[model samples]
Target: MSRIGKKPVALPSGVEAKIDGQTVEVKGPKGVRSFTATDDVTLAVEDGALSVTPRGKSKRARQQWGMTRTMVANLVTGVTDGFKKELEINGVGYRAAMEGKNIKLSLGLSHDVVFQVPDGVTVTAPKNTQLIVEGIDEQQVGQVAANIRAWRKPEPYKGKGIKYVDEYIFRKEGKKK
Candidate 1:
């Protein structure tokens, strides 16, 4: 019934997957990632591909079937290709710089905002206004970018703040004199 759940996840070359009870661990050149599935779904490897199936005819089982399959697919992709997020700072005085293992942001604030880099994720500032976040975990990379953007969201009037590379800010007209 679930189209996505019916498709098995293929293991590319140079990647290995191991199933331990309800947990699936995938190791690749980039890194190793693991995901545990709930009891509502069953995990198995058939003909070099990982598959997930519902345990019963219940609704929860069917839901887990698709969700677990996607989770396993993400693990494979994460270990093989990793994830990346880019941020752009737009403003007259707003800028970002790498300070050793931390990121120093000046978003027109009185003091520089120092963001400490956490383990398993790398933050780099290629230019004063450009930032790149890389990690094996997709969720972590996105969360880091969001936290950075939250510091100085792009304004509607001036569009001065940090935002994603492909994001667009809606402009607003100024008040009449």
Candidate 2:
């Protein structure tokens, strides 16, 4: 049994959830978002709340059920509030700077890489090494942050690269000589 899946997602004030067949739509003060539940997943709304359940107990079904439910809940919450992700750049000469809607990053590479930030997604780097990504959609915020981090993952040796805030970098000992 999934712990988060069991709880009914509470709809915030002025937030509304509507189910039309497999599609579930959420509207809130922030914005609106919708998702369609798959065959293994089912969605239900009651008393200003939403709940998702699986049709079977199989592993695949359970996964689909949990993922869909979580996505739906996230949509509701995101529409009501918002989401944010923080990233930190490590390593000498590795820093980030923003230019208009595009962010320029220097990860000790031959040249700087420029990444375009999508609309509704905001990025800020108070310090050259610290980054903050904010948006209404959690997935987009996370994906963009991950893509930026992928430019230079923290290496095990020097642990220098881009990484999320509070993320631990596991160091690996050098091979025996």
Candidate 3:
């Protein structure tokens, strides 16, 4: 009954997928990633594609069907195209720079904030106000970007802070005495 679950994930050339019990492991040129689904769903790789099916008519099985299928698809995509997140810094004297394996941020604070880059994820500052985070794992890439943005979230008044490149800040009118 899940539309997404009904579709099989196609395996491209140079990409391989293997199924072992409830776990699905995908390997591609970029890297390898695996996902373990719950017993409510079954996994299989056939016809150069991976598929997921519910084990029963129960609600839990139905719920897991779609999620499990998406997880497997993510594993395939991660090992192939990978993921990226961009951040923009907006504020006077606020900027970012790459310091070896970490990022140094100046958010108009008393002292600069040093964020350590985790393994499997790369953070690069193309410009003083721009940061690019990339990794084969979607979750890690997104989390790293979020953590960087957390250092100085955008404020509504002046819209001065760090935010996603595509993010929009709702500005409020200043006080009119």
Best TM-score goes to which candidate? 3
Q: Give the Å shift of residue 140 in candidate 1.
A: 0.8
Residue-level lDDT of model 3, residues 87-136, one tens digit each, is 99999999999999999999999999999999999999999999999998
Worst 10 residues of 3 by lDDT: 18-27
lDDT of 1 by residue, 124-173 (tens): 88899999999999888899889989999999998999989999899999
Query: What does candidate 1 score on TM?
Result: 0.97
Model 3 misplaced stretches (Cα beyond 4 Å): none
lDDT of 3 at 151: 92
Q: What is the lDDT of every predicted structure here?
A: 0.92, 0.88, 0.93
| For model 1, the run of ten residues with the poorest summed lDDT | 71-80
What residue pairs clash in candidate 1, if any at all?
none
| Candidate 1 residue 143 C-alpha distance from true site, Å | 0.9
User: How large is the C-alpha RMSD of every model relative to the true structure?
Assistant: 0.9, 2.6, 0.7
Candidates ranked, most accurate by lDDT first:
3, 1, 2
Weakest 10 consecutive residues, lDDT, candidate 2?
Answer: 60-69
